[model samples]
Target: MHRLITVALAVALGLGAGSQAAVPFYDTYQLQCRANFGAAFNLPAGSFFTSSTPAINNAGQVAVNLVNVNVPGNPPGVWFGQGGTGQVKFVAADSNATIGSISLNHLGRAVFPQNFTSPNGVYFYDAPSDTSGLLTTQPIGASSFGTPIVNDLGQVGYRVSFLGSNAWVSFAGAPPVAFHAVEAALDAASPYSFLFTPSFNNSRQIAGKVRLGAAGQTGENRPDQIRIINPDGTFTIIAHDRDSDPNSLFLSFDNSVALTDNGWVAFNANLFPAGRGVFFSNGVETRTIAVNTAGIVSTIESFGPAASASGLVAFRAFENNTALRAIWIGDGTTLRRVVREHDIVPTDLGPARIDQHDASPVFGGSITINRYGDVAFNAALTPPDNNQIEWGSGIFVALARTPGDVDCDGDVDFDDIDAFVAALSGPAAYAAQYPDCRWLNADCDGDGDVDFDDIDPFVALIGS
Candidate 1:
C-alpha cells in the first residue's frame, strides 16, 4: 500500500515518508489524545481519573485531574500531560485540600483553587517556575464557589463571594484587584446578583451572568443575563431579554457563558416555551444559534456550550426522533458532527478506538477548544475484547484535521504513512486499529478508491 515516490521528490518536498494532511476538521480522521488513564509522571504510580473535563492549550498540552490510587488516601488533584506519553504528571496536592475547578492557559500554566480557605488554598502552579503559591492571600469567605481561570497573558481570574452577598472577580496580580464586585460590577439595581463568574478574553474583557430588574414591562420580570465588563470598567449587555420583543415574548439567559478574544459571546438562554438553546452575540445582534433545521423534528440541544476564538461553538445535540446523540461544532454557517458513539478512529498507534459513550455534557464534560481549532473532550471508550484492558473514560484531543497529518498528531510528518495505510484498509481495519478514530474517505485523487492514483496529488499537497 506504500506510495512509490522518487527519492528526489521526497527530498525536494522537505517531508519524510509519512508526511501528509490527515484529514479536514469536518471529515474522517483520527483523534490524537493529550491525556488518558495511566500513572502520574510525578508520582510514577497508577492513577484514576474522574469523568470531569480537562483543559487544553494551544501547545497540545492537557491539564487533567488525576487521583493517585497508589497513595493510601487516594489523594486527587490537577496534573499536566501530553498525549502519546506514558505518564500524566502531578501539578499540586495539598493534604485535606480539594481542588474545586482548574483551567489552563495558552502558556500551559495551571490555575486552580483549593478549599474555601482564601489567602491559603488558591494558587497558580507554573511548570517552568517549579513553584506554587498563594495568588491572593486576602480572606475570601468560604462560599464553596470559584472557578480558577488562566488567560493568555498569564492572568488568573477567580470569583470571591458568599452566597447571596456581593460577588467579586479577583485577578491575581501584584496586588489582587477585584475585576468586578457587588456594588461596583453593575449599574442597574441596588442589590446585584452574580450567577457564574465572568469569562475572560485575551484583551482582559469579562463576560458573566448577572440579574438585572426590568422595569416598565407587563409580566416581564428581571432576567439573568450575560454582560461584558470591559477594561475601562464599563459593561455591555451581550445577552438579556427582560423586555418586550417583536413577538411579545420574553427571553432570558442561563448562568453559563463563554467569550472569545474577538468579542463573540456564546451563551445559553431560554427562548420562552420553545426550549433552551445556545445564542451568539456579536455585539449588535443576539440570535439563537440553531442546532439543525434539517432534522425531522427540532434538534434537542443540551445546555453545556463552549466557544472558541474563531467563532466555532462546540456542544451536544441529539435528534428529536432517533435520539441519536452527537458532538457538533458550528461556525454560525456550517455545522458538522465532530464525533458520535460507535465511530471508528484512524490512527497509527497500531489499533483504532471507538467512542463508547456520549461526550459528557456541559459542566462535567465540556469541549475545550484551542486556537488551532483543536478540541479536547472527554469520552468513555469501548474496550477491545481481545485481552486489551477496558478503554475506560479519558480526555481526548482532536486536531481540526490537517490533510496529511494522518497520525492526527496535528502535522504532516513521517509517521502518517502507517495511519494512511490503515485507512486504506477500509473501515473494519480502521476500527480495529484505532477505536477512537473515524474512518476517512481517503480517495485523494477522486478515483473512487483510496489507491495508487491518490498518491501523487496527496504528496504534492503535502509538499505545497
Candidate 2:
C-alpha cells in the first residue's frame, strides 16, 4: 500500500517538473493517506490512527493524535505527531494510563495529559529540543485543561474544567477566568448557550460561534452566529439570517469565522435569511459579499489566519450528499473555487457513499488560508485496497496553495519576494545558504522566472 502511494507521488513530482514553483500542500504519516511524501509512513499493527482534528502553527508545524503500538502485554498511551518530520512521540512513560486532549502552538510546542485529567502531569513538548515539561512548573494554577490554541507569541488559550466546574481559558501566568457563555435570551431555563475558541490572530482577537437557545424559541434561535472578542473584554456579534422566512421553522446561521492580523473578520452567512450562499466581512463596512453557496457549515473543524488585508474568507463548501466538495475563497465581491478531487472511477475505485449533513466523504479537519488566498485543509483520498472501500479509506490529502505564491515563502507571494530580495541584497551568501529563498519564492508577475520581475516590490522597499 505504501509503495503504491509513493509511486503515485513520484509520478506527480515528475509531471510537475515544468512548474518548479508548485509545492505539495500536505505531509502525511505512513501510507494511511496521500500526502506530499508519497505515503512512506504507516502505523505498526498494534498502533492505531487518530482523528485528523490537527492543530497547525504559523511555522507549518502540525500536531495530530495517535495511539501506541500494542505489544503482547503493554498498555496504550496517548501520542502526538509532529509536522516538520511526521515524528510521533508518546507524552511519556506512565503517561498513557488514559487519553485526553492535545494542543500545539505555532512554535510546535505541545501540551497533553500524562494521564487523563491528571492536573499535575500535563506536559508541554518543546518542538526544537523534543523535551517535555510538567505543567505544574508553569505559573498557571489549574489542575486540568483541554482544547488549547496557541498563537505565534506562545499565548495559549485552553478550556480548563477545574475544581468540578465549567470550562474557561487560562493564560500562561494569570489566574484563569471562566469563559462566559453567550446569553441571547437573558431569561430561560438553562438558556443553553456556549462558545469555544475556533481561531485566533496575533492581535489576541478570537473568532468563534455563540449558540443561542434551542431550535424552537421566542423571536428565533441563532445557532452558530460568528462573534469576535478582543483581549480588552469587548465583543461584537455577526449573524446572518439564512431562512429569511420571517416565520421560518429553522434558523441556520454561519458556523465558520476567521480573522486577519489587520483587524478584518470574515464569515459565511445566509445573505438574507433565505439561506442562499452569501459572505460577509467586517472591515470598514458591514455589508454582504458575493457568494454562490448557502453557507459554510457552522462546524469549521479547522481554520487558519485570513490571507488578505481586503478580507477574503476561504473554506470548503458543499450542497449535500451526492455532490462535489470544493475549496472556496471569497474576497467579498469575487468568489473562487480553488481545489477539488477527481471522481472515483467505478471500475477501479467502486461505489462511493456520502453522509447526509456534510455530504463530503471525509471528515472536515482544520483549514488555514495564508495572506495570498492559498487554502490549506486536511482532506481525504482512498488508498489502493482491493475490495474494502469505506473502512480502509484514508483521509489526509493536502493540496497546493492556489494562485501560486501570493505571500511567497519559498512556496509562493509578496512575503516570499520581500524575504528573497532582503536575503539576496543583504549578503552574497544569502541565496546560497537559503536556496529556498531564491528557488521557492513566488513569481507573481509570471515572467517565466522568479528574478528581478519578482523583486520589483523589494526595489520599491529599498527606495522607500
Task: Judging by lDDT against the true structure, name the best candidate.
Answer: 1
Q: Estimate each model's TM-score.
A: 0.69, 0.61
Q: What lDDT tens digits, residue by residue, belong to model 2 across residues 213-244?
A: 64234344444456566654466655434323
- Give the Å shift of residue 460 in candidate 1: 17
Among all windows of 10 consecutive residues in model 1, the one with the lowest summed lDDT is 212-221
With candidate 2 superimposed using the best TM-score fit, by how many Å does residue 313's alpha carbon deviate from the native? Answer: 3.6
Candidate 1, residues 320-437, lDDT tens digits: the string is 5555566666665546667665555543333435444334431235677765556776655544333244344545666565355445453455554566667667778866876654
